[model samples]
Target: MTQAVAKEPAARPRRGPDRYVPFTEHMGVVRERAAAGEAVFSLELREELLNNHGRGHGGVVMTLLDCAMAHAALSRVNYEREVVTVDMHIAFMGPSTGKLVATGRVTGGGRSVCFCEASIVDASGDVAAQAMGTFRYRDAA
Candidate 1:
């Protein structure tokens, strides 16, 4: 009898406008341009993003915070360079419903690393989560 093996699926190449930020497309994140070293991202509440308790999932909120902080760090560098998360800390303040908005700003940094802070706000403008992150800048290619 011949042995059978399972294969993992291949990663797909990103295309179109979201190529620079592919996750934004997958997560349905929308961006609002901000000043240098700052970023703003938003998403609408959907059933798929909700947890069993009918609130936004913590993982999704964390992802939004991370992405916002990463974008803030990236804004400080050349477009050809990308920022990778080094360390992150987050705090959940409350449940999130309706439209969610995350805003991030670079607090401090050096040549290769940046420090950033972000907060996720619900439709009522209440902070649902806060996060701090350290990111390292590197060449895209």
Candidate 2:
């Protein structure tokens, strides 16, 4: 006689971030796509992410924007050079819903800094938020 047992499966391995980021990991932000001057990320809407108004928290939007912009900046150097956010401005365009996708693109920059813009689109493909940011390349410490 043999006993059969089935245990829960392990978590799926993700391609994930190039570098460790606590907040990004905690927020469950997934890297959808990325390139030299562009990046895309997504987050599944959950109760934990909602605000008092029952929509995605503004901070969540900002976090996604920041991460996306930073990824875009890092990709410019093939994910070798690090970067720090110098400034950011974000505008919320609509209520967040379902899964959200954030897209970031490098507009322009010099050797020391990168200028970027990012936008979050709701599941319906409507823009929910937009952000502009400047990131400076960090000198290795």
User: TM-score per candidate, in order?
Assistant: 0.83, 0.85
Tens-place lDDT digits, model 2, residues 1-141: 999999885565322245556578788999887797899999988999999998989999899999899889878777766788999999999999889999999999988999999999998889999999999987644
Model 1: residues >4 Å from true position, as ranges? 1-18
Note the Cα lDDT for every prediction shown. Answer: 0.84, 0.87
Which RMSD does model 1 reach against the true structure?
A: 5.1
Best lDDT among the predictions, by candidate number? 2
Residue-wise lDDT of candidate 1 within 1-141, one digit each (tens)? 999898875665432223445666677888776458898989887999999999999988999998788878877773446778989999999999999999999999998889999999998899999999999987766
